[model samples]
Target: MRVLIIGAGGFVGRHLLPNLRDEGMEIIPTGRSPDRLRRLFPGCPVQQCDLSRDRAADWLPRLAGIDAVINLAGLIRDGAGGFDDVHEQGAKALFDACLAAGVRRVIQVSALGADEMGTSAYHRSKKAADDHLASLDPEGGRMDWAVLRPSLVIGRGGASTEMLAALAAAPLPLRLGPGDWRVQPLHVDDLVVIIIRLLHRREPFAGRLDLVGPEPMTTDTLTLTLRRWLGLPPARFLPLPRPLLALGAALGDRFGFGPASRDSLAMLAAGNVGDDSAVRAFLGRPARPLAQALARHPAMAADRWRARLLPLATPIRLLLAAIWIWTGIVSLGLYPVEGSYALLAPLGLTGLSATLALYGGALLDLGLGLALLLRWRPVAIGAAQLALMAVYTALISLYLPDLWLHPFGAISKNLAVAGATLAMMAMEAEHG
Candidate 1:
């Protein structure tokens, strides 16, 4: 059967595509970036279509000869489009196009909290699309649709999984607020199995299914489990008050960093527990527990390295930025200009040349520092930082060799900073 998978470039979609292809299904994947999709799933027919930007008319052509549709499109945080556009309008348009094109089945992979009781905009917007799809009826009345509301899906390549694992691997793990917030974490692989079952089943199963794990777990328990999975020893967590977490969420909202936004905080407080009977019956077995699922695939060396190094990536970047920026500020008149020029004069720099070298080097330092801070072309910035450090160290060693033996180890510290920069670059490349 031919299937059209929307948002096929997302984490869940990436997993689902290969599984379906191995099951002998003709897959037509659609995402915002066709080039990326091609790179991700070679030899498969991929289409470039943005649900938020593309309308029903734009989607009609892609729906031709499609036997089934699975919409895994969602956003944790708004970008390029708000929640309403992506979750509501875009989804509605896709459903409409499906009906118009005579597609028989659609499975919407929505979130667990997306219901009438949902408080966050993320949930409410999802509910809107779910309602719209439920309300639609085609001329033949043969349309079969199921809304699968999955809890926190945990598996490799999942953003939430990576984030939680990194947090667990931190030297000092933090217990946010009371640490009582709970979730029924489902394995992404299990979710995929259910979708495949739904697609192949002869009997029509129409309605919503809350796909969740066998048991609910507290956030603390979840993190601890992840930590143990990484083969790390148990750690004492540093407790953080609700106010501090709230402040961090506020900062995350303002700066667009991390996953501590207000909406997520509210959702966490509400919790993500749900009945798993539907999932169990649908799959003909209980879903795998988080610990068991993780244990089945032992954490490889790369996994352990990722868990350990990810948390340190930001701090390393910040430290390097501060070093470069502070040095520039000190050189640009915060310290005596005469001293800077005196340091430069040993290399035959004098008069206007000395002044130019002093100020010009200071400006370059400031620019590199700001680039690191802003995360602009990190690989390039890292290379530049390394090269500049090498040049400075070589010049100092040749002209002012005594400074290397100074009590402060001022010249010696550059080696350590250069090493840090290389580490940061490796992390960036790993992420990309």
Candidate 2:
């Protein structure tokens, strides 16, 4: 059977594509990035489509000759209010298009806790889409529509899984408040298998079903389990006040680092457990246990190290940026100008020339700090920083060699800083 899979470039899509390909079904994968989709599903028909922004009529032509449409398109959290567009209006458009195209089946991958009175925007939007799709054509029986509302899904490359894994990799013990909230974790592999079975069955399955694991786990237990899976020692954790966490999230949202907003906190507060009988009935067996799933995909040291170190980049960049910005501020007004001139005078910089050099260097430092913090041309910024440090060190060594032996180790410290800058540049180049 030919199928159209929207949002086929996401984490779920990454797993689903390979599995679907193995099933020998003709697949049409569509998403925002045509290049990425092409790479992921080479030799298969791939279409560039954005459900949140594009017109439904535009996607209709592509839907032609497609037997089924599986919408895995969704956003966990969005700062730009794109969730409503993608979840509600986007699903509406796709449903209309599917009906018009006479598509035989449509499967919507929604989340657990999706209801009319959902607490979070993410859940509310998902519920709105589910309701809209469920309201169509029960009497006529024209389309086979199925909605799978799975609880927390765990798999390699999943955003939520990665986040948890990274947290588990932390150097010190990590605490996420009381962590009493419970969730029935579902394996992505299990979910995919169920979908495949449903697709192959002669009888169509209609209505919403919860796809969850056989056992429920509390947040704290889950966290500790993941930590043990990563081969880490027993770590202590302290409960954090919900209000304090919310305050931090609000601040993080403003800075773009914090994707975990109040909505997510709300969702966490409400628990994410569901009945798994439907999933078991479809799978013909009980769902995979959390321990078994974790054991099956044993954690690698390299992955753990990468996860642990990756988060350090932000703080390191900020620290380095702050150093430069502070240096600029001091050079501009805080530090006596006479001392700056005295230091530069040895190198023949005097009068207007010395003033220009001092102020100009300060401005350059300020600009570099801002650029680094903003992540504008990160590779170039890293390269520039290395070059500047090297030049400064050379000039200092040549002009005032005695400073190298000073107690503060001002000139010597540049060696380490330059190395860090070089490492940053190297990392950026390799990753890019």
Candidate 3:
């Protein structure tokens, strides 16, 4: 059987492609970016289709001879415009095209808590699409549609899972209000098996089904489970008022950095859970427990270290930037010129030359710090800091060798700072 997989460049598609290949099914991956799709699914045919813009006529030609269409295309975090365009309008356009092309089967991977009266725009948009697909002509029609609304899909490679892991590995507990809301996280591997089974089922399946795990867990318990898996010590949490958090989320939304948002917080407050009967019936066994699923894939020392450092990345970067800016300020005018000249004189700098060197180095430091703060080319920033530190150490050793032996150990501290900077770079390269 040939399957047309939309959003094949996503987390689910990355796993689903290999599963389909193992089952000896021909795969056609489609996404907005042809280059990315090709990179994700090499040696496979890829088609470019933007759900936000394309219409039924645009997709009709691509559905030629396609046995089934798996529309796994949707957004979890986006602006309202993006949510409406991609989820609601996109689903209608694609489903209509599928009907027109006489595609026999279609499966939609939706979130578990999707509803018409969803607290978040994400849920509302997803529900709109799910409703549209279900309302399609079922009687005397060629389409056989089923929507799989799985709870939190936990996998090693998914972005959400990574975020959760990072949060769990944090030095301090991140308390989103009380962290009392519960969720049933389904293992992605298990979810994929169910999808493959549905594809090969003798009788076509229809309607929406919740694919959740065996047990429900509070958000606090979820974090603790991941923390335990990563061998982290128990951490304390400081719960702030919900209104304060909402304000912070609003600010974060405006600045594009904070994790919490109004809708996201509301969604979290509401909770995400569903019955696991359908999942158990389909798998012929209980769904994998959250801890078991996590322990199945052991995390390396580097992975653990990476997780521990992920939370510190932003703060460290800002600290380094502040150091540079402060140094620049002191060098510019705050520090006595006589002392600054005394330090520069040994290196054969004096008068205008000394002034230029002092101010110029200060400006360079300020600029580097600003670049680091802005998160512009993190790897390059780390490398530059190391190079600058090395140069300063060498110059100090040659010109004022006694400073190295001083009690303060000012020059010596750069070694640890450089190491920290390297760690930051590593985290950025991996997750940035």
Candidate 4:
């Protein structure tokens, strides 16, 4: 059947579009950006449409002859679009157009709390749209209408998931309220199956349903899941009162960073877990556990495994660099330190310039340490570290008269740092 998918450019679009393909639905998708739509459904018919400004009613005629309409089109645009424009105005635009086009079925992708009157403007608007979509005419029957309200969808490759990954690995950690707040996170794939099921459900289930996972997880347990999935070190949380949380939201408004909105914080506090029976009943297969989902979702878990080792590698590099540089520094007539004979002599660059050699060694060691720990530039710092060490080893053997004593020791230390630097660079190359 010919199906039109709106907001098919978003995170939801990525999975939903592909699943629709599996269902053999002839897809016509629209998004705010054509480029994103192209990436979302390459080679499929994708057109640019914006509910924010463009007359969606105008596109109604364009979508003529479509059998079903999937309205995933909504706004989270910094509270600017508000529920008024998107949910109310946008819904009417699509509804009028769909009615004119004789589209029999429409499935709305809305959030869990859309029905609540006092919810954030965005949610209030979504609920209004849900109410409106439910009110559509029944043509031959109640225009096969189903609404899916999924809780936080956990998946790899989405913006929220990426941000979650960053939050998981951050040294400063996140400032969450009491860790008691709970949410049921649905894996995108599992949620996709439900959405796909709604497209052509023979069982005849309708109306608003909360699509959520099997278990409820607190913010603390969520963080712990992130730690395991992301493989980051321990978190450092700084507490802030509810008033300050509002202040943080205001600052985010000023700074354009879009941290947790007041509504989002309220969501965290309220512990939203959508109803599960319909989804559980429909899938027949139980929802995957959060941990298994964490392991399975590659976007969050693939590079995730590397973040765990970053902290350990950082300190080890720092210590090794220190020892390498320290050996060079203490060798300059300050003490009768004898380790690794002269590395440079034939070029006639030694004596106090030999002191410059120690300075060079210090720079390389410190630079490499920072690079590995992500405190410094990877390419420049690694190069500096390797270059300086190579020079120092060669100069030491060449200049010191005790060159034959332990020549290999001088080369070995420089070689060690160079090897480590190269290894790090190689892994980055491979991953990139």
Candidate 5:
């Protein structure tokens, strides 16, 4: 079957085309940007025509041989005319063109809650188009349409990831007061499978359908999941007051960021949830778990690792270096381990400092070394080691009264962080 996917250069579209092509079906992909369309699907036919900007009259004739048209094109902006231009107007134009081209089987990629009241303009526009598609039928009355309504389509690419990475990379001290918002993220691969199935079914169309992942998680959990994938410190989400957020939204709008703040908060507030039983039954396979999905994503993981580990290298190196120096002095001047304890103990300075520098710092160094040489979990290992050392320092400072210089150890410890961290990275790179 020939499948014509509009907006075939977007996140979901980019993920979908390869699957369809692998199935050995010819695909005609359309997008707004000619370069993007060509870059995404070089072998498959690509047409550059913005559904909102260009009239369908010029492209409908070219869509002559299209059997099924999947519209993935949509706009995501708040206020004024962005939604109307892309979501509604663009979709309507594409549908009209598909109809003229005699493309009967249309699969509309709609969003959850689009048909519900109080939905955003983006949601409302999708709902309106969905309603229009459901109303159309041939004289014989074969419904000839199916809708794949996905909530929070999560993929390793595109705007959502860029946004998440940007937020994760911020340098300011973050403090969030109890993040409890629940959300679900669907894997683009799973959603694409459902879409492929929907495109071929000849049976009478049912009402709007929904596709979702198998798990639900809190916003805090989501942030942590992203952190683990990136090997970065967990995101510290501070709860901005609603009024402050509103002011931010206003500022963002003024600065031409659209209404990202308002819309994002609205989404976070409502929470994205849906029933997945319907599609799961059809797929005969459970949706990919968010954790598993992230683990399998190396590109996102690499990008995030670069963001997290690279900047902290200098400080970490300095700390590692300080730890070594302090340990070296304590072991050489004060604490002696190998020789007789009678001689070493009477020295009064105690070999504990020297022992810590040689042994404790070595353990720290080797642990850090292994962390860099291997690609297991560097941030996690670093955090654990830091905690342990901090506790050790606190205990010694309290009991011994003379060795309050432990904090200074961390100053030199960070020097080895880079080499060890890189070893781990190299291992991961080679295996991956």
Candidate 6:
């Protein structure tokens, strides 16, 4: 059977595509970026389409000759479109196109807690699309639709998993909320299996299915479990008050940094547990627990390193920034101007030339520092900082070699700073 996989470039879609292909199903992947899709699934037919922007008429051509459509498109935070646009309007449009094109089946991958009573905007928007799909006439049109509301989906390369792993790898993980916010993490592999079953089933199944793991675990237990999987010893957690978490969430909202946003916190507080009976009956077996699922694929050396280093990225970046900014401040006025001029004298710089060198170097240091702190073209800025450091070291060695052996080891400290800068750059590239 031919299947159209929407948002096929996502984390879950990446895992699902290969498995479906192995099952002998012809696949056509669609996403906003066709180039990326082609790169991901080489030689596979792909179409460029943005659900948020595309109407039913625009999606009609893509729907032609499609036997089934599986929509995996979703956004944790708003990007280019809001939740309502991507989740509700765009989804409704795609379902309409599916119906108009005589497509018989659709599987919507929605989040748990997506219902009329959903508090978070993410859940509420998802509910809107699920409702629209359920409202469609299945019996009259022979349309078979199933909505899969999965809880926290844990797997390799998943953003949430990566974030949680980083937290677990921290020297002292911060306990967010009251440590009672529970989540039933469904392995991405099981989720894939469930979808395959729904697709291959002969009988029509219309309505929502809460796909969750056999066990529901609290956030603290979840973190400790991840730590154990990573072969790390348990460490005491630093408790964060609700006010602090709220403040961090506000900052995250403003800066778009980590995963501490208001919506996410609210959803966590509400809890994400559900009955696993539906999944068990559908799969003919119980869903794998978190510990068992993680044990199946042991954490590799790279995974362990990634988790450990990811948390340090921000701190290293800030340290580099502080070094540059303070050095600039010292050069500008804090340090005696005469001493700077004296140092420049060794390079044949004097009077106006010496003054310009001092101030110019200070401004350059300040600029690099601010750029590093703000995270503007971070990789590029890091390269620039490295180059500048090299130049400074070379000039200092040629002119004032004695400073290298000074009591403070002024020139020697640059080696450590340079290493830290390189580490920061590597982490940024990996995370991005």
Model 3 / residue 421 / CA error / Å: 1.8
In terms of lDDT, the poorest run of 10 residues in model 1 is 134-143
Q: Which pairs of residues collide in candidate 6?
A: none
TM-score of candidate 5 on Cα atoms, chains taken together: 0.65
Clashes of 3: 0
Candidate 4 lDDT at 56 equals 57
lDDT of 1: 0.87
Cα-based TM-score, every candidate = 0.93, 0.90, 0.83, 0.66, 0.65, 0.90
**Could you give candidate 6's per-residue lDDT for residues 1-432 as a string of tens digits?**
999999999999999999999999999999999988998999899999987899999999998899899999987765445788898999999999988898989999999999877988889889999988988865525789999999999988787888788878888865767777899999998999999988898887798999899989999888888888888888998777888878977877776676667888788888999999988988899898888889988999888998887667788998999999999999999999889999999999999999999999999999999998998878889999999999999999999999999999899999999999999999787534
Best by lDDT: 6
lDDT of 4 at 279: 72
Per-residue accuracy of model 1 over 1-432 as CA lDDT, tens digit each: 999999998889998999999999999989888988898999999988887888999989999999999999987776445788989999999999998999989989899989989988889999999988888852225788999999999988787788788878888776757878999999888998999998998876568888899999998998898888888889898777889878977876775556567777788888999999998898888999889988877888788788877668778988889989998998889998888888888999999999998999999999999998887877789999899999999999999999999999999998888889999999877445
Q: Which stretches of candidate 6 lie over 4 Å from their true place?
A: 33-35, 79-81, 138-142, 172-174, 235-237, 351-356
What tens-digit string does per-residue lDDT give for candidate 3 at 1-432? 999999998889898989998999999999988988887788899999999998999999999999999988976556658888998898889999998999988998988888655667888888988888888865415578888999888887676676677778777866657788888899888988988988888775678888999988988888888777788889886565688878966865664553456667777678788899999888999898988987888777766776666557678878887887788888888999889999999999999999899989989888888888787887898899889889989999999898888898878888888988887787677434
- Candidate achieving the largest TM-score: 1
- lDDT of the candidates, in the order given: 0.87, 0.81, 0.83, 0.66, 0.64, 0.88
RMSD for each of the candidates: 2.3, 2.8, 3.6, 9.6, 15.0, 2.6
Which residues of candidate 4, in runs, are more than 4 Å off? 138-142, 203-205, 233-244, 299-432
lDDT of 6: 0.88
Better of 1 and 5 by TM-score: 1
Model 5 C-alpha lDDT per residue in residues 1-432, reported as the tens digit of each score: 898888887789989999888888899888767666776678777776776665568668867887788888876554567677777777777777767778867888888778766366667888878876776653315436777778777766655554444445555322122456667778787888888777656665556777777877766666666656666665446554556656755655554442245666576667778788866776897788877876777545567655455334434544554544455455454555564233334334356754454465545645554553332454555455556556655645555545334576542343344455444444334222
What C-alpha lDDT, on a 0 to 100 scale, does residue 403 get in candidate 5? 38
Worst 10 residues of 3 by lDDT: 251-260
Ranking 3 against 4 by TM-score, winner: 3
lDDT for predicted candidate 4 compared with the true structure:
0.66
TM-score of candidate 2 on Cα atoms, chains taken together: 0.90
